[model samples]
Target: MTGFCNMVIISLFNWIYILSFFVVYTADAGVQNHHVDKQNNSKRLLMDENYYTIMSRLDNLTKEVEALKKENALLRHSPIAFLAELTKTVSGQNHQIHFDQVKVNIGNAYYPSHGNFIASVNGLYQFSITACSTANHYVVLELTVNTSVVGKVLAGDTGYDECSSKTFLIQLSSGDDVFVQHKSQGDYLLSASAYGFPSFSGVLLRAL
Candidate 1:
């Protein structure tokens, strides 16, 4: 009876040791799982932050591209340019020289009948004029902007035909008038095909 009781006590101790080992192993495994879950959460948060940053940058780039496209389209559609030539001899002082022969009037800003360039928009403009005079006759031409003289040129020689030219850059408002007129001096002009015809030309440099 004593031997049986001792064997029974030893068996119970072995079972207790095995149960304690299993409980320790299970607790360690739970700790490991919790650590892994924390690492995965950190990784997920970092990935989400990077994605949002990249998306914001891409959206700003798209907006900039759209603005550039609109500016390019506006520049392409609105163009102002014109060129005309004096077709016949002009006489008289203070006369408005009519460059009636149209060469390239892209914007229709130049009027051959009235000999004037009317501004369509407020802008900085460049204008040029070429004048030729008959032999022994001197001509002084003036470029006028709304009755204001902005430029002048004189063309004449002692026994030969002469030519002179002038260019001007001015700011203009919409509906402003620009034209070439003879100043006080000799007024006869030559119109020979051998020489280039007297010409008036203008272009819009920039919109105000």
Candidate 2:
């Protein structure tokens, strides 16, 4: 009976040891599985963050490109330049007149000459003129465009009353010419001025 009892106790001990070993192995496997799952989740989160960053960068680049395109278009369509031409005529000793600072040179002394002042763009032109005489002088001023007379002014009073200025709103073409003429037969001291060419700065962009 004693021998039988000892044999039973040893059998029970061996069974408990085997069960404990299996439980430990199972716990270790579970732990390894949890660690692998955590690692996978971490990798996925990093990938999502990187993808968002890349998309944001691409969006910003696209906006910049669009803005550049608009700027380029505006520059291409804007007007290029504006121009101004001026001339003056002074009375000689007798009834003779001399032309100075003629912006456009058309013909020689004999034939009826034509001169031009062109604006590079089509816009409202502010035409102006100022004239004065030392003595009682009679002067006829005629404004012309493309050789066609548009308006006229006469100055022949005793004092500064005859000194006058005129401004006109003129629509100009790319290569149009504006000119002034002395209509009266007698020679008179005269001076003329103009502004608005080569981009509204009173400078000529081209010679015509």
TM-score of each: 0.64, 0.42
TM-score quality measure for candidate 2: 0.42
**Which candidate's TM-score is highest?**
1
Model 2, C-alpha of 91: deviation from truth (Å): 25
Off by over 4 Å in 2: 78-208
Model 1: ten consecutive residues of lowest lDDT: 70-79
User: Runs in model 1 with CA error above 4 Å?
Assistant: 1-77
lDDT of 1 at 33: 99
Clashing pairs in 2: 82-197, 82-198, 82-199, 83-196, 83-197, 83-198, 84-197
What's the true lDDT of residue 5 in model 1?
98
